[model samples]
Target: MAFEVFKKSSAPVSTVPSVTIQKRGLISLNRAAYELIGSPEAVELLWDSDRRVVGLRATDLANPDAYPARPQSAQSNRGPILVAGSLFTRYIGLDTTEAKRWVPQVEDGILTLDLKVEGQPVSSNRRGTGESARETK
Candidate 1:
């Protein structure tokens, strides 16, 4: 399942926006490469666009919203998208800001936000608040 990012309210939280829908039952990229072009004896290495040895990380490119992993040829409907994030943001404070911390919400509707207080370096335990609704101005 994939995660969804939603905006909390000081009054009351509401329905989440349909940004990136998650899917399960697909093979991972690693496994795909092994089946796609790997040898029958050894595992191969992969490089990024920069020609550097890439490592597993939490990035946006491998994410559903950014670049969701495609399903494998074998598993048609029950495959999971084992995605990874990419650190290729050209700007800072874009989504890692106080009012724009994008959290991952499971398909079951369980959201896990990596948020902190505004202007704080993720140290303050202010947590969050609940607002009514944005439509009620």
Candidate 2:
């Protein structure tokens, strides 16, 4: 009585080492506050030593789905974690150059990112080169 739909791909999945954000100094300190927080205004900023990431607790200006909007009875809930600096370096191996590219711009009260993908195309076909798989050097 029920059915599920699925899509398949033969192309090899590729990922970028890192993305560069153009025109905004390397990694703005308030990047997370504007982007993830959904607004430049914040109620409080806490350094969560446990997660090694800053926690940005939202006030009334936060998004409707923000963690703070959850019922107070949900004692097990935690706010969002803002990753940066060594925290990103340790976890995502974010280098200085990469870290510097992580910036967010605020326009008309909305946060946005301007980035471009830079990488080589990956072929999905498994067939050995045009010559032959057993070709000798």
Candidate 3:
């Protein structure tokens, strides 16, 4: 008489990792991992395009998973939207006046503030003045 032996597969099963994204463009991270990264203004997300990190975006501080699973971080400064420059317009023959009106636009993870002079849109730079001020952050 001959006996047959049944063998089980030896290869380990692979599973997809879980990822969460918020409407405000913040990638979700576990509490422990967030703390381990020094609580930066933004967390780096890696995309497997070229086998390395390709880009960086600011994390939404209001994401629920950020702290205690809250819906928003209105009371915290974890990822505040920093003003890159002074909200003012320098016009020729006119005193420097603060931008009375401004419009904000966000596209592809970039925030652009379109400042206006007395409700009229104007470029940030002075047209004729040689003054060139570059914003540094």
Candidate 4:
């Protein structure tokens, strides 16, 4: 059947003897005799990194009659959240100056602390800064 060729892979392309995608959809063939026509797109999309792939909404049907599978090297990562205030704000403003900081009250638990470059508190409350940054509410 005539499958709209997408980006060519590094592998070989299958050359069908004859194929057609018309109003009746894709049709498969055997050179001399057997020809079977399908009613829908020959290749079904299975999964995508984003909900909309190539700017068009795709489906979860990858292959017909195929079992659930996972692509090689597929993964998702969500880290932590770090609350930061502008440097212009007073450093003490981030300390126990208000009831907002739980670090001062709960020193035994996951209490946040001050971040200073040389000696001044930058008020950068971060955990594994680059690694963990997603906040969950």
Using lDDT as the measure, the top candidate is: 2
lDDT of 1: 0.27
**In angstroms, how far off is 4's CA in candidate 3?**
41
How far off is model 2, as Cα RMSD?
17.5
Backbone clash numbers for all candidates listed: 24, 0, 0, 3
Per-residue lDDT, model 4, residue 49, is: 28
Predicted candidate 2 versus true structure: per-residue lDDT over 1-28, tens digit per residue: 7543321222212221121221221222
Q: For model 4, how does the per-residue alpha-carbon lDDT over 87-132 read when each residue is reduced to its tens digit?
A: 2123222232221211111122211122221111112233554553
Error of 2 at 69 (Å): 20
Computed on alpha carbons, the lDDT of every model, listed in order, comes to 0.27, 0.31, 0.28, 0.21
Kindly list the per-residue Cα lDDT of model 1 for residues 1-137, writing each as its tens digit: 85443433321212322112112211133232322322122211122333222222222343443434444344564332333232322111224322222223222222222223222121122344663333222
Error of 4 at 117 (Å): 8.0
* Ranking of candidates on lDDT, top first: 2, 3, 1, 4
How do these models rank on TM-score, best leading? Answer: 3, 2, 1, 4
Residue 88 miss distance in model 2 (angstroms): 18
Identify the superior model by TM-score, candidate 1 or candidate 3.
3
Name model 4 segments beyond 4 Å from true. Answer: 1-77, 87-106, 114-137
lDDT of 4: 0.21
Question: For all the candidates, what are their Cα RMSDs to the real structure?
Answer: 16.1, 17.5, 24.8, 28.2
lDDT of 3 by residue, 22-79 (tens): 2223333323223333334543332323322222234555653222223235676442
